[model samples]
Target: MKQRVVPIAVLAGALFAVNVVARLITRFGFDGDDTAQYRITIGMFATIGVILASVAYVRAQKSLPSEWLPSLAAAAIGGMLLTILVGPFLSGGYPFSAGAGNFFSQIWLYGGFAIVGILFGYWIATMLGRDYRSQSLKAFTAAKAGKPRRVVRR
Candidate 1:
């Protein structure tokens, strides 16, 4: 349990850190500029996608998607919750001051990006024939092909 939780927490923390940095930049650097805020948000999402994709690639090499995907989702959700709830306070603003629509939009965006990232990573691993299941199937096929056939006695 610790092993699973620790890594997920670390992933979540790293993601939260990215969010904090983006939020800080938007708050301090951009001030009233919506354009810079939008750009920063987009970049933040892209960074999250890349991070998740990298994690998926690494996990695919050793474990089935079923084993690691839930962890990835949990990490994303945890980080997003922290970013949306706690982050605003840190930035001297209310969490839902932007209204419910914007709040929900954030959730949707984060979830969508996470799913896409994981899929992208897993797809690349499969294409490379390096994923756990792919490697297993390849080994099975190779072993079967290498086996000698027994002759039937008349």
Candidate 2:
């Protein structure tokens, strides 16, 4: 439990930290500039994607998909919640200050980007034949090829 929770919590906190940094930049540097705020938000999302993608690539190398995927999902959700709920306060705004539609859109965007990043990482790992499943399959094939087949009387 500790092993699982600690990594997930750390990933979530990292994601939220990115949001805080973005918020602070926007609040201080572009308080009244809508264009700058939009650009910063997009940049924030891309940074989140890259972070998740790199983590996914590394985790895939170390653990089975069955073991790592759920934890990844949990971390993504935890991160999204922190970004959407606690982030606004740091920027002197409320969660729903932009209205419900914007709030929900943020959720959708976060989930979508997270999925895309994970998929991209998984694809790269698979292509490199370095992911857990690929390595296990390779080992199984090698072991099978090493053994001689027995002749059966028909």
Candidate 3:
């Protein structure tokens, strides 16, 4: 359990770090520029999505989705909370300075991206017939089809 948790926490921290880097760049490099801020935010979201998707893809190769999905979700949620709440302080701003709408919006955006990332990864795995469920189904069908048929007397 410790081994699993350490890696998950590390991954979550890494994801949060991406947000921190984006925030720093936006604050310092694009001060007072709404256009740049918007683009940076979108790019940050995409980066997180790509990270989640890659993690899912790699995990799918050796484990079932059920085994890793919960951990990934927990990590995402944890990292998101830190990014939204603690992140502002690093920029010398209050967490609620942006108002409740902004706070909730961040949550929604993060969650939506995480979900989409996981779905995209799983979809690709299924298409490639590499996911656990897909492989199991394939093997089951093959086994059934390969069995000899019984003949009935008329």
- Please report the candidate that would top TM-score against the real structure: 1
lDDT of 1 by residue, 1-154 (tens): 8988999999999999999999999889998999989889889988998999999999998999899999999998999899889888867888898898988888888888888998999999999999999999999999999999989999
Instruction: State, as a TM-score between 0 and 1, how close model 3 is to the true structure.
Output: 0.87
Residue 104 shift from truth in candidate 3, angstroms: 0.7
- Which candidate tops lDDT? 2
RMSD of 3: 2.5
Backbone collisions counted per model: 0, 0, 0
Give residue 98's lDDT in candidate 1 (0 to 100): 87
Order the candidate numbers by TM-score, best to worst: 1, 2, 3
Residues 1-154 of candidate 2: C-alpha lDDT, one tens digit per residue: 8987999999999999999999999999999999999899989988888888888898899889888999998999999999999998998889999999989989988888899988888889989998988999999999999999989999
Query: Candidate 2 has which clashing residue pairs, if any?
Result: none
Candidate 2's C-alpha runs over 4 A off are 147-154
Model 2 TM-score (2 dp): 0.91
Candidate 3 residue-pair clash tally: 0
Q: How accurate locally is residue 9 in candidate 1, as Cα lDDT from 0 to 100?
A: 98
lDDT against the true structure, per candidate, is 0.90, 0.92, 0.87
lDDT of 3 by residue, 13-91 (tens): 9989999999999899998999998899889988998899888877786679889998988888888888898988876
